[model samples]
Each structure stands twice: as C-alpha cells, then as structure tokens.
Target: MEPDRSTPRTSSRRGFLLTGGALASTLTETSMAQAATRARNTGDADAAPGSPQHPVVTRPADWQPVAERLDGVGRLGTDGLVYRATFPRYDLDLSSYGVSGLVEASYAAFARYPDGRTMLMGDVVATETELQRVTDAVQAHGLEQCAIHKHLLAHRPALWWTHIRGVSTDPVALAVAMRAGLDATATPGPRDPDTAPPAGLDTAAIDAALGAKGVSLDGYRFSFARAETISDDDCVVPPAMGVTTSFTFRSVGHGSAAVSGDFVMTAGEVQQVVKTLRHGGIDVVELHNHALSDNPRLFYLHLWAIGPAVSLARTLRTANAATNLGVVTPDANSSMSTES
Candidate 1:
C-alpha cells in the first residue's frame, strides 16, 4: 500500500495542495472489526522508522516551559503520561454556515517514551495563504508533514489540514518549530472554553447509521472516534491524541449531514476501505499517515460527503468494518475537550 507518490504533495510553494494527500479510487464498505493484518514493504527491508525506544528521562517537566512559549497551556493527561497543548482555530470563523472552533483547532501531543526520546505529533488547520509557510516552517524546524489536504469540500474562506510528526530530546525546540508554522496562519489564540455544540440532527438515528456512538459539538457537528492503541519509542500514546479513526457530521438540514473525517488503517486495508467508501457515495479526498514510524505503519483516509445523515453513517460503518479496530463506544464521562 504505497502512498500515491505519482500524486506528489510538493512543498515547493506552487504545488503544496495537490491531491495524493489520500489514496482512493472508488469503492464502498460497513461493520465492527476488520481482520487485523500487518503491512510490510517487501522491497524496503531496511527502512528506518521515526525513532527507537529508550530508558526513562530525567525531564518530563522540561515540556512545561515549551508549552508556555507557544502561549498554550500544557496539560498532564489524566493518564499521567502524555503532555499535550491545544492551539484552537478560533481565528477562522467557520460560522457563515456555522463550523465549530472545536472542529478546527490544531494540537500536538508529546510523550517521554520509555526509550527516553520524546516524540511530538499533531495537526494544523491552515488556509491557502498560510499553507506554504506553515509547511516550510515545519520542514525547516525538523518536523515532518504527514498529510496536507482539506476537511470541508465547500467551506467559506477555504481551510486546509496538515498532519505533522517529530521526535527529539528537546520537546521545547519541537514546540518552537510548531509555533513558527502556526504564526504563519491566522489561527487565533485559545478562547474561553466553549460547550459542546447543541444538536439539530437526529442523534440516535445518526449513531445507528454509523454503528458507533457520537458526541454533539457546538450545534455545528457530531463527532465519533475509533482509537487504535499505538506507540513509539516504548511509550504509550492515547487514541484521542493522534491515531483515532475520527468521524464528524454537520447537519445540512432535514436529517442530512456534511460528513468529514479520517479512518486509520494498516497498509493492507487501504484499497478495501476505500472501495467501501466509494460504494457508499463517499469521496476519499486524502490518504496518508499521521506519523513517520507508527508501530503498525498506520494510514489515515480523510473523507467527505453530504447526504441523508443516517445513510452516510451506515456507509461509514461499512468503511469502518474494513479496518483493524477496537470497539469504540461513547464515553459517558467523555467531555468535549477531545472535540478535535
């Protein structure tokens, strides 16, 4: 399952936004668990992934000052392991038709792996004008762009999404580089925390159609996540932060929704998952990985479509069935903090 390399995602200023961000032709799919299969490149037997695991570090606290430098608060995840910072996209007023900032914000999670190296991974919400600079900054600062593509097919002001990953002993330097790319965009500072949006769509119907649970977010979108337990450098990273199979539904009125989000899959499953999406009338807009060396070598398939909400959900359920996934039920204690 090679990324469509022929479809180059060049950062050469002029062609950064070309497609190949995702690899899908046409297909459709549903279900709970797809068989688990590992993806290995036969030709590249000596490929090197991001980094190796290491012993415990002397500085978990080292990440704090870096968070402050980014002007974002760093939270010690309740898991007491991963350190995370949120950079909300409050700057883009997706509200002409009402898109939630929760849906648009960019964030990165860092973990001091048992292997001693700290790794950072996150996404940035970029506009056409800011895309190139942000891309340049991350690459310049030693961070890698995992994916660059759009979320909404028809959005006002037009926004593009870029997924980034990096590993270093100096977490603050990684944060500094991340901040540099962010400064290129108009993405605003964090706002007073907002409540999950009120729902206008038939929530129960939507959940049933998708075969998974969802949360109401800012009356703008319904979101769900199927998390895969993945790790790097001998440290554990939660599903919500980086590698979750994410789904979002925004009401288009009369029970229809504008659906957008990504599916995390192993290389072997890409074509099948995409085939299922196409069968359901969904568009596979972007197909790429979230990290350079995720243990299983995961790929994220970003999709978009507008239709009867329940019908789209069911098709998503079919596509979900094509991946190796754990059962992702709604958390009764789940809050909107994981909104993105």
Candidate 2:
C-alpha cells in the first residue's frame, strides 16, 4: 500500500454512488425526525403555562354586583370615580317627530341666561322645533346649554346635534331624569334593517382611512378615540361624562367619500386646528366650548370634508398633530402655556 501511494482508491462507481445515497438518506431521515419533533412540541405548546386555552381564572369582586346593577351603562369604580353615559340621537324627520318638542324645549331653556348657569352646558340641532324642545328640557332639568349645531347635513330627515351637561352628586339619578326627557320624544330607536345604508362615497377608501377593523354598520363606518384628559371644575376630571371623539366616514359613491368627525381640543389647539383644516380644504362647521368650568377647559369642533377617505385621513392626521391630541401625554407645560 505504501508503495502504491500514487494509485487511485479501488472503489467502483456503483459502490461510490451507493455510499453517497445511503448518507443522503440518513441525513434526510434525521431532518425529518427533527421536523416531526418540532411539530409535536408545537402541538404540546397549547398545554404549556400561560397558554390562551388554559388562561388563569380571576376571582370576581363584590363591586361586580353593583356594576351589573348599573346595567354597565354607568359604573362606580374602586378609584372613587363615577362614570356617566352619553346618548346621541339622529333622526331624518325632526319637525313632526314626537321628540322634536323635547329637543326644542331643552335648547331654549339652555339658552336662557339664568338657565345657562344652572344647567352648565347643552347643544341643539338647527330645526326650530328641535331647538325648542331641547331648550325646554334644559330649563326643566336645570341643566345648561353649551352649543346648538348640526352633526351632518343632507341627512335623510335632517339632523341636529345637541351637547348638554349638568353636575350632580348622583349621576345615575341625572341619567334617569335625562331618560325621562328622551322618552317624551318620538326619536326613532336604532335604524331598522330595511333602512338602506346612506348612499355615497368610496367605501374602501373610507375603510382604509378610518383603519376600521369591524364590520360596517348600516353601510357607515366609524372610529372613536377617548379624550386624553377630563377636568372637574378646573382640576383633573373624574370619569363621569362619557367624553369621546368619534370619526365617521360615509360612502358617497364614485370613489368620493364624506368625512366628518368630532375633535376634542383645548383652547390653545383650536386656532391651529382651524387653520390646518382650512388649508386642507375641509370645513369647520362649528367650533365652540363644550364645558363651562372644566379645569383646562375643553372645546369640541364639528368638521366636514368630501374627498377620498385616505386623503381625508391624511388631512385629519395633520390637523390632529396641530393640536395636543393623541394617545400619549401631550407636553403638559407646553399645552398649558399655550392656553394663555
């Protein structure tokens, strides 16, 4: 063997091929075993700790009883805070609607100077009857009127929005009272299925702009964000008023969409918002304060725009940036300083 060092190894071609094949088969079997083992482990992961199916059970608290009794409409939490419910109504027929009278009364009473002080704040639609009922209700409940306006236009029956507020130790009592006023009106309940979705605008674009993930409601889609801070008589607001800003997009057909949303802003941010919307060709239908004595004060603006939903959303983003509005805490010092 030493003498023949230069000679080639003596394995046949077939033998070489057979050896290579066997090695390859061994590798393949090993790989497959590993893959199957991994699959089994993955399947077993369901029984592992912290798995979704084996979620930890939490003990119920006594407060749950009180919360259930409230029908979840309102709740008093352990933090010593009382939450209130806000109800908004839309109707196509305001004048002949039974609730029209109540709406008008509430507005009128809210507008009267003396009534304004006790009531604190309220809002109304433009229709004469609606305003009258709202004013009257404000007077009756000793609540205040804050603004009168329209949330939408060319809506089937005619639409109006009223913002009302009152302060009471017993928020539930207040809600019950408010319900009585609402019951007096023939405001239609939720829309019927037969009621077709509002026609118009590009549905897909609107969906993309809103980032709405849920199913559409009556062909209209909506997104809502909660106010960053609420105030109580110039201090940190307790969570009593269900204060939230909602953005809604309606399909207007032919790739056109209607964009409208409520923005909750502080005094300092109002001018910037107005300017931004104007620059974007959006209309600021109404800009006014919603609360009278709230600490840091809050203002609500009703905005409208007609365009592609994505474009509208971009404009909204710009407008939102102009104000100290977002999920994160705004520069507190900056926001307060700007308020001056």
Candidate 3:
C-alpha cells in the first residue's frame, strides 16, 4: 500500500532538494531521525505525489523572531500564510529607456508548512559587480538560487535579479543564509512604508480596465495566482512564495506609468503570452524558470512598458487572458488550510 497522502513529510527528507548541489551542512542528525520516523510511520520509503499541502496561517507575532534574524521589518499577507520583507535598492540609481522610475527592490518571502518546515523564496537585485559575491554567500550558507535574470529592458547601472530558495526547521537559519546573501550587496536597511499611492494615476480606472482590483504599495500593484496546483518536490508551493503573476505600476509623468512584473506560465502557454504582450507593444525583458523541480515546469517572463496607466493595465489583461489565472484575491490562499 502507498503511504497515506495526508502524512506530512519533514523538510530534510526531500530527495530532490537542490541546494547548491548538496544538502545544507546545518541539517542535523536529529532532523534525519525525524525523517526516518515519519517514513516508518507512513510505510513509505519515497515521497509520493499528493495534494499540495496548505501553508500554516501565521501572525505577525509568529514571525517577529524571523524579522529580527533578517535585521529588517516584515509584513504578513492579509491571508496570513506568507510573511514578506522588502529590501529596496535605494542605493542604485537606475533607468531603462527614458523612464527613470525604475522599481528596484529585493524581497524574501517565508511560508510555514503543516509539517512545521519554513520555506524561503524571493529575489535579490544585485549590481553586475555584486552578482558573484551574492551567489557565493548564499551558496556557502546552504541556500539555493532558483533563477537569475534581468527585470529591465535596457537599463544603466546594469543589474541582475537572482531568485533564492531554502527550507529548514529553523526559520532563523534560513534568515541567516538569506542575510548572508544580502550582506554581499549594498542594499539599504529598513525604512518607512510608502502608504500613499502614486499621484496623478487613477487606480480605479486601472481596476476597471484590468477587471481586477489592485492595492497601493510604493505604487499600485496586483497579484493573481495560477488556477492549477503548483508543486515542487511533490510538495505544494504557495502563491505567496514568489510563484504568482504580478504587476507593479509606478507613475512616470503626465498621467503615464511604468509597469514592471512577471507572468507565471507553463510550457504550452509560453509562446502565446509572449506574442500577446508583444502584440500589445509591451517590452518583454527576460524569460526563465524560478524553481528547479516544480511539476509542470513553470516559466517566468519579465515585462516592462510605459504608457497611460489604464492602457497598460488593459494590455496586461489581454496577456493574462492567455494563461490559466484564477480570480483575484488579496494575497489569496483560500484553498489551502489556515489556522484558527
């Protein structure tokens, strides 16, 4: 008989985990014993594909220690599943095309599994000179770099974005490894949140054009999760872990805005999404994958376009119609389990 699909697997037991080509040196013998106990209890020697496990609902207080470890402030999503910390690249003055309002920031998102493992996923924005050092630091600490590419079309002060991933029973350890990578760059420390939306941009009109509502960050932003189950190493990967389609709009001038974000796509949907965006006159920045062992093999296409805010949103809506995007929810994870 197969192991019960409901049995939760430990973080240290994934046979396909890719952490710089080896398991983190910090995973202890105790973790190994725990994995063995779980396997014995379930009567399964190998991990079996099953329903993606839901992320545990986490409160801000639950992640206070993690924030301390990262030496930055974090905000829990409205859904209470993923806690995210942002490190904007205020140190770098960048520009693409003639648009000077380049949205440059690094982020690390943490999600808790039902089995008590914390998974880390986010991207680091690094200058060309700082890329290798950042990679070396993360690799030395047992974290994995899922993907590396650019988010701008033709930018000065050349930059690279590297997606990082790690899973550990000790969330602080994951924070430490992530911090090591950030330390390699000149990313600034925490600052006040930009509560006000960009001036002269009508977000309501944007919502009407895109057929979805958006929230105000430094600029206006929107996120949509893929309709199908997304799994990595046979474990469910939540939308909050940098897996969703995202768009961030910042006012350029004269009621125009600069939009930058990525669309999460599968192999069959790739060409159509790209063609659709190009047909709408949007600039496709880069195409790549964000995870190594994800089922269905996801693809991420970064995009940039400067136009009237509503027009850009409508063009994005046309591109979105090409994928399997579901309803728009605020930090949505409703299908997954949430703690009371």
Candidate 4:
C-alpha cells in the first residue's frame, strides 16, 4: 500500500508540470494571434474610405488676406504678429504708459479663450467716454476685453492700455471686427522716425557680440536674441508667443553705444535678474506677464542702457545665462499655418 501511494504522488507532480507548460504555450499562442489580428484590422482601416487620406475639409491658401484685414482695422504687422496701429514712443515715460495699459487689456481679453473665441486686446485711452467707446466697439466685434493698465508713471492726457483677442477660422473676419473697435479711439500722434543715437558707438562690434543678424531702425541697431525656452504654464514652453529678448544698440558715437531691450524671465528669476541687470548698468523699466497660462509663467522686463552695442550684447548674454534658457532654431514642421 505504501509503495503504491509514493508512485501516485510522483505521477501527480508530473501531471501538474505538464498542465502548466501546456497552459503557458496556449496563452502565448493566443496573444500572438490577437496581435496579428489587430495589425490586420489597422491596415484595413487605413485602406478604408474617408480617413486622413481623404479629409473632409479643405484649408485656406494664404493668411495674407487675414493680414490685410487686420491692417485695414489699424493693426500693424511687427515681426509677424499684428499689433494695433498706434503712436510709438521711445522715452521710458511715454512707452511705459502705453505698454502698461495695453498689456493689461491684452491679458484680460486672452483669458476668455476657447468658448468665447476672443482672448485679448490692447488700447490707449484717456477719458472715461473714450474708454467706454473702445470697450463698446470691442464687444461689438465679438472680442474679449482682458486688461487696462498703465505702462508709465507720468504722462500727459493720462494714457491707458487695453488687451484683446478673438478665435475664428477667418482671420480677415477677425481683423474687420477688430477694426471697428479701433475706429472708436483717437489716432495716436505720428512717431518721430529720426531719433538719433547718442554717439561714438561701434554698431559692427555690437552685432558681432549678439551673434545673430541685425537690423537697424530709428537710430538703433537691434539684434534679436536666439529664441529660447517658452512656457504656457509652469512646464516647458514653446516658441509661439515670440517672447524674445532683443538687444538694441544706439551709437553713442566713436565706438560707444547705448543698449536696451526686453528680457523674458520666470517669476522666480525676476529679483535675481533685476539685480544682475542693474549691476551691469541696465535700467529696468517694466516687469509684467504677457500671457495667462504660459507653462513656465514668463515675466517680461523692458530694460535699457547707454553703452557700446557690443558691450550691451555681452551684458545681455550674461543675463541669459541666469535662467534655464537655450537658443533654438525652429524646424520646418514646427511652422504651422493659422488657417481654417
């Protein structure tokens, strides 16, 4: 009886191993067969009608019409983005006033995103009636009004700024609507195009320092800093806002120059950056947010200095190093059309 029991136990162990091995083999076969079936289904779907291969809608040709419409409404193209056609001021006092008010409105408008279509708008206003007129016009245009803050401390006629935005498949249509809003405000005085550089500045050396192509305008030769990290929230940022730090040099004459431009930074870096710029003899004008949900939460500080352009560029490079930013050139596929 004992011998028979031992034999049965041995047979039982062998049977369990055999069953586990067979079950494992069966499961593997089933998994492989399911994967192959899924692959075939995916291939069949790609070959089916009405896929991305046969899209349902057509895209527009060019955004030129949209640009023209924006222009018609008193919006000017600078660098690429359409800005409202308004008087330009070089003085920190006046420019600050304009930028402050304009930036406020712009931020407020942009906050309405997705559902409302209108996001941000910018304006320069004085009288209460003028403000109302601008607001009324903006609402009529289906745009969202975001902010109205001051860029400068002291200015005549009390200048103010407004920010505005809108979402639409038709860019031209958006422009036309915006134009109606601008028509309500007073036309800004003509900007002086002949502002002279200080003197004795070496523009060539400055350009070389910046290490990028330069463009001269209104007595100042400007070098665009390489595009760096952009953010939409507190995460890594993309380069959609055109939030670049430009270094502009004004020849002080005889190899000397004055430099000025904006430096984009995060809230955490503001104090350190301001100190750094001041140590380099740069004037900090305005520090503010240009967007609501930029991941890294960017802050822009408009800075100025009177020095050699090259020296200014070097100083700016030093400031650039204080942040987690790196120069980057956009790729071809990265360029997207704002078409419907």
Candidate 5:
C-alpha cells in the first residue's frame, strides 16, 4: 500500500463479562460509562492548549508482551511510532454477500507520551447484542468508550461500532484493560495473515483522489485515515484515539465500488461537509455525534456511493477537507500524517 498525501481528514471478540459496582440505581449503562469517564478526567482542571504533560510512569509497550496479553500479533508502524493489533470477526457473514472482510476490530498507535506515560487508542466493531457487554468491560476496566455508532446501512446482524480510549503510565496495565474488553465478546485470537488479493479498484486513482495514504485488503477493500491530534478537556488527546476521517472502499466490479464509512468532524465543520457530499452526488447516510464530551466534540457522517473508485475518492476528499484538519494546529511534537 502506498501513501496518498492529499489534504485531510482522516474490533473483536466475545466473552461474558461480570461487572461489579456499588452505585445509585438511576444511572443506565451509558450514563454510568460517562460518569466513569468524568471521574477519570477530574484531575485535568488547568490543562494546557495542546498535548498533555504527564508524569512518566513506565516504559512503552513491548511487541511480544502486548501480543501475548491480547492473544494477537502486534505490528509496529514506523510512520507514526504506533503499534497495532487487528482481530477480525471471521464469524460474520458480510463476506457471504461478497462484502469481503469488512468486519475487523483493531487497536492502533500505542505510543509513549512526552512525559514517559503511555497512551493507546482504537476502534472496536461489535454487534447490537455484543455492544453493551463490551462497553461494560471497557468502563469496568477504566477505559473510555468515546463513541458508538454504525458504519454500514441495514446490514445483517445489525452491527454497531465503538471507539476505545485510555492512558496510563503502565502500558501493560492498559493492554490488560483492553484485553478485558475484548474478552467480553466472541472475538477470536491471532490467525494467519492472509495474502493481499487484488482490490480490483484503481488504487492509484483513489490515492490521487483523496490525497492520503490507505491500505488495500486482499484486493477486496481499501481504507485510509486522515490523521489529527485533538484537544478538548484542556489536554492534548492522542490522534489514534478516535480523531480520524476514515474512508473504506469496497469493490463491486467493473471499476465501481460500494463506498461506506465515516468522517470525524467538529460541530462547526458538519454542514458544509454534507453540502460537499451532495454536490458530488453522494448520499449522506447518517449524521450523528460519536462521543459525549470529547475535547473538540466530534461529529461523524456515515456516507455511501456507487461509482468509479477515483470519482468517489475525489468527492470524499472534498468532504474530508471540511473538518478541522488544516484549521487546527497539531501538537508541536506530534508526527501525525494529514493532508487537506
């Protein structure tokens, strides 16, 4: 996969989780999760404008150690000093209809904060039945469930997607917590890496259209993230957390594709983005907020289209540029990749 330098934008398992807590009876699971988040963030009163400064606690996550903890293989991306583990749901049937490997759960970009603390962020895709239990595990482990929504329209199994976020001086502890959440579902462990099949779409044309880099999945799918570091509650939030404008291209044949995925945007950037999509003859499937109180209040738009891959990529790039990419100053120390 090659990198596309265009202007910007930018899950697993199954297990039964037993949760324990003493609390008032009025709070629902979602509210309780929000409360847990607030309690975790209570210390950030006088935060600075950009990246966070925290006391060094432990070393960053080791490759084999983290892999062993999560029952998967962790690969490091030198581009952003990020290590990620991907757990795919082979149990799902989207592939039966030729959608082909669209259901993947991944935790990416585990890195050390400047102060020596560790931060990690990821997206975990689960179904309706599995969503609550997964969120419970995340909250029980003190990890934050920042956003919850869908990526496709009217797919069977009624899937829902959620973004996971956490920070600690102890990277191992973070992995343990992440593993706890993964265990709450039927998410499987490491598997043999599949060979890349031809994606069939003109990938070079897509790169040119979006002006960003994305990876081709066995010739079935193409995905990219326009990365950005975010700040909301007076702290420098890591970009890998849930702050990317992501696009996924599914090949449908004859140089056309079925476009599905979402864009991460600030509240101020939403309307014009929708306009841009409509201008390109694309349909805005759903527009909604992903998180409750993230620093910049992220809004996501799930979009769909059917056309030449390059044509859709160019249209998506326009919509992507409407977000906070070029408008925001990235953390001075951040090595994030973005174009817009």
Candidate 6:
C-alpha cells in the first residue's frame, strides 16, 4: 500500500509539471501571435516607440496654414512632435527687476495624433484687465482653461499667464479659437526678425557650466526635457509642448545677465529645486500647476536671478541637476518654419 501511495504521488507531480509546461507553451504561442497581429496592424514590425501610435509628425507645408491662422510664425520643435509659435508681449512695456521681456512671452503649440485629432497647448499672457476677457474668449470657443498663474514675483503692468488646452479634429478651427483669445489681449503679432545683438556673456563657459548648448533666440536660451515620459489624458505629451525646463539669459551688462524661466519638476523634486535655487540666491517667483490632468503631477517654479553669467549658469545647472533630465542631441529631422 505504501509503495502504491508513493507511485501515485510521483505520477501526480509529473502530471502537474506536464500541465504547467503545456500551459506556459500555450501562453507563449498566444502572446507571440497577438504581438504579430498587432505589429501587422500597426506596421510597427520592430515595435519601435514613436511609431504609428504616437503623434503624426507634420511637414512644414502642413503646418504653414496653422501658422497663418495664428498670424504668427511657427517652428516645428526639434523633437518633431510639436509645432510651436511664440507671441512676445512686445506691446506691454513690462519690467521686472530691471529687466524687460524677461518673461514677457506667450506661446501656442499644436500636436497631431495618429487618430487625426489635434491638441493645442498654449500660455496666453494677459494684463490684469485682459485676463477675464481672455478667459471668456477661450471658453467661448470651447477651449479648456487649464491654469492661471503668474511667472514673476513683482512686475509692472501686472501680467497673468493663462494655460490653455483644446482638442479638435479641425486644427485650423482650434487655431482660430486660440486667435480669438489672443485678440482679447494686446499681445503683439508675429515675431520680427531677431535683430538683437549677440549675448555679451561668455558663451563657451556658460555652455560648459550648464552642459547644454544655448540658442540665441530672443535671449541666450537653453531648453531641457525630462528623462521620463509625461502624459495627459492618457496621451503622451511632448517636451516642446510647453513642458521643457527653460532658461533664458539676457546680458544686463558688464558680464552679468538677468536670468528668468521656469523649472518643470515633479512633486517630490519641488522642494529640493526651490531650496537649491534659493540657496544660490535665486528668487522663486511662483509655484503652480500648468495642466489639469497631467500624470505624475508637474509643478513649475518660475525663477529670477541676476549675476555673473557663468555663476548664474552654474546655479541653474545645480538646480537642473536636482531633477531627472536627459542629454540634448541635435536631430537631423528637425526643422523650423517661419510661415506667417
């Protein structure tokens, strides 16, 4: 009887192994078949990201009309996912800490998804008097008013930044809605050719200090994207869609520069960045949300500082290192269109 019991126990063990193996094999086969089907359906044979499931990148010609609709020149961001146009508040004689135009700009960005829908993200700069009208106009056209906040601690003419979001199958219609909001404010038209002089700061040292190349647009500018994916409403949000940590340095003269921009931070990194920047003598202007339903919940801390160009760069570098960031690389597919 004992011998028979042991034999049964051994047979049971063998059967379990056989069933487990067969089940695993079946699962593998099913998974492989499903993957193959998906690959075929998506034409993503290599399963590369930013494939057909991601935003539909547009050519310059495709976005020219959008630019015209905004009555502004648009630039296809370096990532090729977002087309962006800026509205510098040139009409406002704004000044903050002896600097004008330090943070006096608004922008509209359009991203096209594979589903043939377009999303708009913009920050419309308005005066205290114009804010209500701007909000009314944006809501009148069915755009979502995501956030309202300030980018400076104290400034003349009292400006407000309104973050806007909208989705439409008709992108030109979306632009018209955005244009309606802009019309409610005194924000100027398309940018003029940048006739400003070269930033009189030490460029090489600034680059080395920040570990990123600077572009001479409006000011000596540096843009850094986060290392991780950020999304809104389950769709990936590109960095150029007003999510990048931006720093603009304008020479205040005698090797010193006035620096102002925002740091895009996660919840946990906010205090650290603030402490680091304050410890470096940078004034933390405002802390606020830029979107309604962004995953990981981003907080933007607008900052201001005036110091030696390299010293300020080093301070910003330290603050930047307080968060997760990816290295910048120039891509060949990137092109900026100035169509208006």
Best by TM-score: 3
Off by over 4 Å in 5: 1-51, 54-63, 95-101, 192-199, 218-229, 232-235, 291-293, 324-340
Provide backbone clash counts, one per model: 24, 45, 0, 58, 29, 0
Q: Give Cα distance to truth, residue 117, candidate 5, Å.
A: 3.1
The 10-residue segment of model 1 with minimum total lDDT is: 13-22
Candidate closest to the true structure, highest lDDT:
3
lDDT on C-alpha atoms for all candidate structures: 0.59, 0.40, 0.71, 0.41, 0.55, 0.68
Ranking by lDDT: 3, 6, 1, 5, 4, 2
lDDT at position 56, candidate 2: 12
Candidate 1 has an lDDT of 0.59
Deviation of model 2 at 293, angstroms: 1.1
Candidate 4 least-lDDT 10 residues: 10-19
Candidate 3 lDDT over residue span 82-201, tens digit each: 777777777777788886745577888887665556777777889999999999998777777877888778898899988887776667777777788899999988765465878889
Poorest 10 consecutive residues of model 5 by lDDT? Answer: 15-24
Kindly state the number of residue pairs that clash in model 6.
0
Score candidate 6 by lDDT.
Answer: 0.68
Per-candidate RMSD vs. true structure?
11.6, 26.6, 8.9, 20.7, 12.6, 15.6
Evaluated against the true structure, the overall lDDT of model 5 is: 0.55
Global CA lDDT computed for model 2: 0.40
TM-score of 4: 0.54
TM-score of each: 0.70, 0.54, 0.81, 0.54, 0.70, 0.80
Candidate 1 Cα deviation (angstroms), residue 243:
1.0
Tell me the lDDT of model 6 at 144: 79
C-alpha-based local distance difference test score of model 3: 0.71
